[model samples]
Target: MKRTTIIALMMLFGISFSKAQTSPTAEDKIHSFVSIKNPPTFPGGMAAFYKFLGENIKYPEQAKKENIQGTVFVSFVIEKDGSVSNVKTVRGLGAGTDQEAERVLGLSPNWVAGTLDGKPVRVKYNIPIKFANKTAK
Candidate 1:
């Protein structure tokens, strides 16, 4: 009787441990962007997108003059249709840096949407923007 009770308790604990180790289902892990439908292609790839940012982003003169420098982390949802939406700054520095990061992300042309199980899926991407002061020789 003692051995049987010990075995039963061990089985119960094992079952509970197994349950805790189970991963969440795909549906449960889906992000909000997955529910919204979007377009199929972005105008350019990553290289071109970066080029756009370099060309368009204006480093704040005041910040640069003061030698303020930091990285801004921007988060956005890439829709299944290749369109980027819900642009926001996850990490930021003051001195007009975060706004510039948001502006650049918002202006980005679509991107190649990510896929899961051979179907387009919304994915979250984080972009880091850096600002540095340029010194005159």
Candidate 2:
């Protein structure tokens, strides 16, 4: 009886360990940005751009008070050389939301370069930023 119990526990442990090692699915990879080449260039790179947003972004106080929460989708092009350009809003909820999205993206730092056919290529990327009103809670 003791040997049987030990073998059962070992089998359970092996099964659980194998399950933990499985790879993530494609959907799990969507939210992250991975560059094929070195990091791309922007006027100020990501840090400077984020700083610009931090300085300029005004949280819609009214929206926050009302607990408005939504995701803003921003699309922009990254040049072949890795420079950020042509930023625009693909989706927005308003309440000064679109402008806010544009402002944040425009101020984004350069991204790591992308590649096509193993060569550097310009690509358009889209990102969604979520805003939640903590005050409402």
Candidate 3:
């Protein structure tokens, strides 16, 4: 009985230890631009980045018809591998503009990952995408 109890306790302890090892801790969730030494950037500089957005982003038909015009603020995480994820709209305009902004960011290419202490790390990034419609005079 004593040997059996000891074995059971050992198994329980081993399972708990493995669980702890696999679970993410507070430190593991520490991806933020505030703590990073350098923030992520697109392949080119801001000028080129804005040009890319203008070219790739499509004005939603509904938004265009409704004459919706405003800037959509998007927030996303740039991973250590330079891939983007967790895209969300912090501020949005109606008439499908919010969805369009998210779509454009989703289709963006991998950026230069942010760095912390010169080591590549995930960082949070925010950008404002503008939508405007011009009618003939």
In terms of lDDT, which candidate is strongest? Answer: 3
- 10 residues in a row with least lDDT, candidate 3: 25-34
Clash pairs, candidate 1, are 39-81, 42-110
lDDT score, candidate 3, position 122: 71
Better of 2 and 3 by TM-score: 3
Instruction: Point out the worst 10-residue segment of candidate 1 by lDDT.
Output: 32-41
User: For residues 20-122, what per-residue lDDT tens digits would candidate 1 score against the true structure?
Assistant: 8897656434354334354233456656777888898898776776677878888887776767777899998878888888987888776776666667776
The 10-residue segment of model 2 with minimum total lDDT is 26-35
Computed on alpha carbons, the lDDT of every model, listed in order, comes to: 0.74, 0.66, 0.84
Q: Where is model 3 more than 4 Å wrong at Cα? A: 1-27
CA deviation > 4 Å runs, candidate 2: 1-58
As a TM-score, model 1 comes out at 0.63
Instruction: Put down candidate 2 lDDT per residue, 89-129, tens digits, no spaces.
Output: 89876777678778767665666566545655666667776
Q: How far is candidate 3 from the true structure (C-alpha RMSD, Å)?
A: 4.6
Candidate 2: give its CA RMSD in angstroms: 11.3
Residue-by-residue lDDT tens digits, candidate 3, 39-122:
888899768878988998888899878888989999988888888899999999979999988888888899998777777877
